[model samples]
Target chain A: MVESLVKEYTGKLPVKLLGELKDKLTAQKINKTRAKKIFETTLQEYLDAQVAPGEAVGIIAAESIGEPGTQMTLNTFHFAGVSEMNVTTGLPRIIEVFDGRKNIATPMMDVYLKAPYNKGKDIRKLALLIKQSTLQDIIKEVNTDLMNGKIEVEILSAKLDDHGLAQAQLKKILEKGLKGVNVKIDGSLITLAPSSKESNLNDLYKLKEKLKKIHMSGLKGVTHVLPVKRDEEFVIMTAGSKLKEVLELEFVDETRTVSNDIYEIAENLGIEAARTAVMNEVFKVINAQGLTIDERHIVLVADMMCVTGGIKGITRYGIVSEKASVLARASFETPIKHLISAALTGEEDYLNSVVENVMINQPIPTGTGMPKLSTK
Target chain B: MPKVDPTKHILVPKHSKLSEAEQKKLFDKHNINFNDLPIILASDPAITHLKLVKGDVVKIDRDSPTAGKSEYFRGVQ
Candidate 1:
């Protein structure tokens, strides 16, 4: 009977832990019936730790995250290894997460590589490949010739060799990026002459500046890549995030690689990935400040954001605006707008949720209020 | 067009519409109005594959870490 019980829970419990429990029981000379009873009691205790029905999980989650949020100092810090990259952290980052901002202030990604690439070797080459370089990066100087109505751009030969870029490639990119300009490349010097039709000195100067920012090579949005060693694995940290393009790379580990931008993840992967990103990002900020909040609370917040099949912020214009009850919407920010709009639409407030019920001075439909006393 | 499988998604719970008899039995057993129950939109992906229309009942089977496997019923709105 003991052997049968162990077989029953083989996959459910860790094999080593189960074996230890069985050995402990056998050493005590406990009978089969008693062992089975003990096992059932343990299982019941584990199950009972789960949340009860009608629990106000949303309010609890809000408090759990909000309390820690107040303790965080409002500060934006530069990325450790990369001096040019600055990321918004602490309270502001928390706000950004809850608000579900589409374009994050500092869009960044922690890109993990697959297999041999994740090891220390060949990370520098990979970082250079991922870091987006523009025309300005390889150019020594840009000079505008007002009298000639042309722009002279000096290509740094050393810089070009360092980045492994050819002059022909730059000329091709320039022609494609700027429509009404003739590109002429001679050795290490490139000149751009504006078309006669659009040849105001101001426009030529503007063209020179625009040409300096043209995309030359690497991922489109990525600005900088800093290779950092974490947990004995080499990972590239990019300044500007392009999660879709980054994931498409052959060497990138799709499962482990993630971006701090939540909406980008939703667009690239799906709502599920966005939900996980939200939870992980919140946890990272909270944990960095040496605070411990229950993981379940964070999970609840993520679930609320993703329940509608899309990521929605807990803001007046987002999830709050989409509430079914007019009263509920009015309780949130910009109450006049919501109430006036609802009045115009002749919308009805069913008062099903807590906010609407509380607004009307009624018992909220949760906990003891959930049960109705009917004599029928 | 190939149907997108909703079950393969991690966040989307397995869902199926309750039959008329089963829904009736549930309402009678709980002694509650349909609207009183929790709501899931008609456009929700979990029930989209089921082709559930408005006012239909969907049984959501969620495999929760804490609760093991739990079932929830929602009225499609």
Candidate 2:
């Protein structure tokens, strides 16, 4: 009877909500008459709770987000000692998301890996594999004596095994990578004393710089990596994001690996994913700040920014610039520039938006003022 | 190795182009114009397989966190 009865309100209310109502009704001793009354009242209340026609929801959403935003701290909060990645958090993160800035302050990625790797197996090696490693990263100290025409590099051999590196392999790499200097490996120490050419201080300094710049391992754009165990799985959280490159890795779970960069997401995954990222990122910051804004507000903002299939920021050069009303665009930023351009184009402001109407001292076509009455 | 598919990504929702009848019904229900709906690029990787042209309406079945499951629509551009 409950299943049959609930079917009546199918399109009127959400399926899940109706199912819950049906479950509640079935538990109690209720007749068909009482059940119908309950269903009818539920629908009535749902309708009553809906936003009234012509309500200015955009303004409300802005105020709701902005009010709590003022209290947020600017500093990036640190996770326990394991992960020292300085991810942009708080108010700055919110601004960055809304602005859709290409060069974000701290672009990071949550790179999920496949199988045993995700379960913290050979984690340090995996981290090293992902991290952009240079000769400088492994060097503990470097001593250069211009008098002896030699530069000795002391390696941190303690964690070399963790990075899946052996002394011989390192020696070979150093030998192949450097041309001017004769590379000599003595256990954990590497001595580069030029044999063919007598090198000066300047030549030695340039060689030192070149040695530091040698690309040893890892993908491009992923500079720092830390294997972090979250819940039951370990995720390789990286300081820099190279979504395309990371996704291409055999061990990486391409389906789940994600970058916080909105532009990167848009370029690779299209605008819908970019929109979702915007919403999720904003939600994460707001949630972390102990603020409770309705998720609808965030959703609306994301939809507005991504509605045109290209992600646009809320800034003057973005969403604001594309407005049909000249007054609206002028109001956002650079008043004279927009006004003059509108004049040149012979643009007519239809006064469709609230700002245009307010400029002309007309009743805004929103809530209460929306309906017009005619008389003969 | 297989190339990554944008449509199969976790963040992307299920997308399908609606029939003309379905589009008409949706517009009638919402009292909406084609321009009023959100716009999706014809070249969007998620919908490229559909071979949709500009002006076609797309339906997205999104499992939204706040509003539960909702069906959203966009006009191809």
Candidate 3:
């Protein structure tokens, strides 16, 4: 039993400690390479301390790095290389809600195809290449130009194909970079035109050939070509770019989604701004959901949410205290694990026994089990 | 009589280990007049269980079957 438990604990030690150590190193601005070295050395020291230790240091090192309580977001992010590629209406604005910021716009191609063109397509790979080649490159180019004090050119929509006109207004946008650009790639029909910039047609054709030279498939010396379908023309086109190179840009407004109970509480209390009032709203919502929260936790949340400007997911900054970050990580797995780990370290045999006993549905002593009627 | 203190000590009937003479001797040695002490159980199960009480002077035995050894716990009764 002891061996198995130790094995289990030791197995989790490396990975868990790695994450904690990484976070600590990130906060300290220790480079990734140095951080990895420290992690290995520290882990070795921890195992060594148990057997033959001149200086027992693992616990101290662990404690220093193992901050327990931090809130983390389950939210994934979208980065369009060009800032303004709209997937849907107000999609760019919605990205801001989830903390996105790269707003520099350029020609972005959003590929949509009819029926047969959809299967066996790795659109993500294509998106990545185009985004890497265009939007990110453009920023570097522009920034370099600005630093060198050179005038910037208005590099707009690249090219559009013929069958893409099937999209009507979307096709027109692709052609001219109107409200937005659209891109459609169908078989055997490559038409390149811009409604607004017919004069830039020569430039568009040259760029199209450059784009075709990109080997999207793993065919040696074979450049990308429009596939021809019998009686159906292949089409590929261009539009306004919406790729964001960086994740979470600056000064995007964040919205706090309050529960209806909180709204009701605020509406009734009419104290929208006070910190205490905010806590009350939070607790009211929590209670409405039939969950109990400790007053200390409430106070902590209030201080973080109201006073600290911690709007849900944006505060990926600052050093989180050891206790809080651990709790935060543990909470994601199991709050009970957090409770046990907080109450007792791995060294506490009695605590481990009690926890294990409780897990197995065995009879364990509590308040009323204090040797009632005396032991025999 | 230097304005004699009126406090008194009484012995509970259950703990009768201390004889009247022993009690008086203890009182005198401690400069505690009989009136200054409170009632205490003599030889009560609690006295033995915790091995303590007011004016306790007792010898307790500590024997462990696992270690197969014996030790002594001595205290004032």
Per-candidate total of colliding backbone pairs: 0, 0, 48
**How well does candidate 1 reproduce the true complex, by DockQ?**
0.12
Candidate 2 residue A98 C-alpha distance from true site, Å: 1.4
Chain B TM-score for the candidates in order: 0.83, 0.91, 0.29
lDDT of 3 by residue, A13-51 (tens): 444454455557657876545655665677677677443
Q: Give interface RMSD, every candidate, in order.
A: 7.2, 1.5, 34.2
Cα lDDT tens digits for candidate 2, A16-41: 67868978988996898888988899
Clashing residue pairs, candidate 2?
none
CAPRI grade, predicted model 3 = incorrect
Best by DockQ: 2
Which ten residues in a row are the worst by lDDT in model 1 chain B? B1-10
Models ranked on TM-score: 2, 1, 3
How does model 2 score by TM-score? 0.87
Instruction: After superposing candidate 3 on the true structure, give the runs of residues whose Cα lies further than 4 Å from its correct spot.
Output: A1-166, A178-190, A193-202, A209-302, A308-376, B1-77
Winning candidate number (TM-score): 2
Count: clashes, candidate 3 = 48
Expressed as tens digits, the lDDT of each residue in A1-376 for candidate 1 is 6688888876565455566678888789788889988777766765586567788878888898888877898888888867777889888988899888888899998999989999976787778777888888888888888888888989888777666677787788889999988999998889899766756878987897798788877797888888999999999999989876777777777657778998776765555556667887988888888888887788787777766657888898778867888888787788898888888999887779898888779999998788778896
Q: Model 3 — interface RMS deviation?
A: 34.2
- How many clashing pairs in candidate 1? 0
